[model samples]
Target: MEIVKGSGFIPGDLLSKINSPSDLKKLNEDQLEQISSELRQYIIDLVSVKGGHFGASLGVVELTVALHYIFNTPYDQLVWDVGHQAYGHKILTGRRDNFHTNRVYKGLSGFPKRSESEYDTFGVGHSSTSISAALGMAVASKYKNLKDKQHIAVIGDGAMTAGLAFEGLNHAGVENANLLVVLNDNCMSIDPNVGALKEYLTDITTSHTYNKAKDKVWELLGKISKFGPNAQEIASKIENAVKTSLLKQSNLFESLKFRYFGPVDGHDVVRLTKVLADLKDIPGPKILHILTKKGKGYKFSEEGNETVWHSPGLFNKDTGEIIKVIPKTPQPPKYQDVFGHTIVELAEKNLNIVGITPAMPSGCSLNIMMKAMPDRAFDVGIAEQHAVTFSGGLASQGLVPFCNIYSSFMQRAYDQVIHDVALQNLKVIFCLDRGGLAGADGPTHHGAYDIAYFRCIPKMIVSAPMNEEELRNLMYTAQLDEVKTAFSIRYPRGQGVMVDWKTPFKKIEIGKGRKIKDGKELAILSLGHPGNLVTEAIERLKEQGINAAHYDMRFAKPIDEALLHEVFTSYTKIITVEDGCIIGGMGSAVLEFMADKNYSARVVRLGIPDNFIEHGEQVELYEECGFSPKKIAETAIEILKENKQTILKQGGTSLHDKQA
Candidate 1:
């Protein structure tokens, strides 16, 4: 392993000694403190160049060091919620050498994967699973009669706001499992957390009356415990009674039957280690509330918007200045920006239009709408299930709620989408941003199944835009007063093809497709952003004397039967391509349509396969799945040649002549 040594790189001589959690156990409290500083600096220097999740990892450096130091990891389970804060945990657990390759293709995963390491007991990418996983581990240990083993779950306050966290808490409280849930309260999760829970936690952490009362009660109980079991029982009853009556307003965790501990300083390695060591001796489900600032120890990150600095692209470590590589040519706006800007414009004209995102205003570009119309826009915290149902409620009252959620996150609220919106036939327009491979975020973040999931449901209109203009038009059409069905518009992560995409809002016909090029013998049909690849492939095929017709079939659910009949009647061969999984995707839809209509044109399907794709650049992933322009062109060429051979073998006229 190479030790990065330079002006910016902090002296990590102490850090270099740490190969595993057992290695950390060898170090004293003072040395552990040094390791914490080194770990934070190492992450700062590493992420400065490589660019991964910044704020969460930086905030949890001390906690990571302390947990491993106190607990026997690989035996004692430590499940990290969301896995953004697990970088330090990964580094300390024998991944330090390969840490630089984080989030890269075929490199170490950015999040925890059980297959990656034995230390990673549970794979995690989404938030609020840690408590449940930890409780399960604790229960499993008990089943095996292994009382010596411990289970700890470190979760952020932002993730704790989710309903899943509460469900886990409710179950764990009832189970009375030997589990410790460390709440890393940084008052943020991408953006500052909102709602009643945030307010409640803020009050508990800040209230002098609550703190003083808790201290006095504990002090009285400790003194009374010295009088033996009889007096101790009386003391305990009195304490519980007092707490249940007076502390009910603040201590919600205790109400759930878990022993709640302090708002301790999360950055103090020595104090955190001591607290963790003490907590190990105690029994049952517990929650240690530690207060830490997001983007701690870095001056610029501390001063700037921590939200932007959370995953700000590569930057200079010493100066904290973001390294912006200027593009050689003018580039098109991102699909997210198109949605962000267009919603504000549409909302201005239509007062009924409102935007809601599940704790992703900045991510989905709904921050633009939030800034323009504060009353109309809502950041509903990390609650996908609630966000969907809340939108349903708004839609019920005759409001046009544009529920903007990431494609992957939408899976959490599928029940609500079916029950609240689809069943009621409410006009809730779902703008699924990141509707394809989510690039570096990998399989957990990819929006590969929305088309299949939504298309299977009744009264749900599923569509994907080929470009920025189409997305804008789709938004316009969905928001129209006449449209009553539940509509979903999925668009990809990065920039769109059109530079001048701020075209006037024109309504797109539902279940309609337009041909991009004229050709013979083969017709290449595509859905969503993959149509851009089809367009490029068709143009390239033209140079090879292989003219193939291209169509952007916008709607996946409502198949354009009229266009399909025309293509099947005209062409001898047909190809379907999409950016989602092949099994139940656009290609599958086409195959199902063909079988029902009995139009057999020798169909070929191309898309992501049945298996999960790992982290990589979007282009590389698309190419791997055979959805890239070059790959699509190659497939088209192969199909065209085979069709020609079939025609020749049949003693028919030339392929072009037959088609003509």
Candidate 2:
């Protein structure tokens, strides 16, 4: 293993001294700076080797070091918003040895998990949760009358765009809680931030006059305090009034009742520590805006596009060139690629077609579409609520809007989906990419709840595609004016089953399923990509002399009741498989349909266990959850044998009589 050296360290000098956060306290401020450089290089090398989140951790290296050094962490609660930037914090807090295993299955989680370390105050993956969670902890500490401790929330500028962040700010401001919100401003949020608030923050950060005046006011206030209490009060009021007036137009943080500070250079460790140490003495909700570059160290990462370096694959550490993997055959298109390409193709012919993604053009594969039809495709930054309502606005103006949001991210726009789209009955197609276990991204990125949530909303057509062709067809069908309802189509993250991409698009009959094979003893009904497992299970059953029928019930909400009823009457045993949880999922939908008609067929639900799945490879996770083809086959055989034994005991009736 070729070791990359960083500034202020020989090889293993700094790493050897630190075992945990407590070990970090022994190091002085000057030494801590040296360690920060070493840590940054270590992170760079590790990410280069193992392909994990890069830019976020790089941006927070100094801040992470400063926080642990200044604050009595574990006891003095420090919560990281989104937790992508906690890689440094993790290394410092006794996980340095295991850092290489980050994002791997059953290994170190990419984000701060409560189970992983006590220093990690809260688990985070979804953005904008830090302030609220920290404030809650602060309030809980107060309720317990613990006055010695401190509570701080370190959030990125991008995460601050979330509505929940504002909600936390508003509530914390009124509560007068001793909460410190460190806004780690890199001027990006997955993509550059959108909305008026982001622009306002940018303007404030750039305003030299505002910062200089505020500094002079502080100096004047300090001198006046020596005269008398009355003089100090007058000076304080005057300074605040001046600061408020100058910042009034542009300061969103101050308006939310926070004592706004900084636009501080986040990279300056000494300055950051000094500022943080000063803020430790002060009380109430405060905002410390620290500006840093996203990919701070190493020449290529520093100069390279932040987004490309954000979560890059395995790369050559020396050149920062990503190690490209040649495909055995033509590699199947990523689900996002399919969505992006299909939308562009649709937009080329239809003048009304508009594409909108909530700050995930690159992730959702809409970047190409955005480039091709810049006017039509919109990247609405991290504001999912705004994206949905904006799409609604476009729909009202006689445009066919495709609001492509990650299935997990759409949770942020649930209210907008219910009120703006479904309530108004707008023709908007929600292209939900990563609709199930998103592998390494973990539970925070899982698209598990969309089926349950979207199904309940009235006037919404919720569907999932079994393969690439079906996805394209569904996208086409969703665009039609006749489908004057809010439509959603979810698909998994990676490539669909290797099918011929040249097949012409066709509109699949909505709320229908196709019987793929015929059998007598057992049946496997499934939806989405998990349906592929049924084919393997059926072939395995044939070898065992157990004839198993298979049906691909593509639509989850408007289920194919006719096909389901026929299968229920025909088969002695029925199994429903899906990639999602059984509770209120595809299997539950099938069971609900069966119960509505007072039909009872011996049914076995084969799907993800009703528990949050941890980060892992998609294949490993599928097998663990019993969604893999091998597990499906074994499960089917076990259930069939059990049913056969019960039938023999009861003296089995003929197939015709059982149907009657």
TM-scores for every candidate against the unseen true structure? 0.95, 0.93
lDDT by residue for model 1 (1-660), tens: 454433234338878878899888998877877898889888998899989999989999989999999899989999999898999999899888788888999889999999999999998999988998899999988888888899999999889878999999999998867899999999999999988888888887787766667655545544553455466366456547656654565468887988776667798888788778766766688888899988998898999999988899899988989998889988899999999999999999999999999999999999999999999999999999999999999999999999999999999999999999999999999999999899998998999899899989998999999999999999999999989989999999998998889999999999998887767758999998899999888888888887789888999979898988888778768899998888888888888888898886788899888899999999999999898999999998887778778877997775458445
lDDT comparing candidate 2 with the true structure: 0.83
Question: Which stretches in model 1 have alpha-carbon errors above 4 Å?
Answer: 1-11, 211-249, 645-655
TM-score of 2: 0.93
Which ten contiguous residues of candidate 2 have the minimum total lDDT? 2-11
> What would the C-alpha RMSD of candidate 1 be, to one decimal place?
2.9
Model 2 stretches astray by more than 4 angstroms: 1-11, 211-250, 653-660
What is the per-residue lDDT of model 2 for residues 536-616, given as tens digits with 9 covering 90 to 100?
878877898877889989888788999988987787578888877778888888889889978888788877787999998
lDDT of 1 at 158: 88
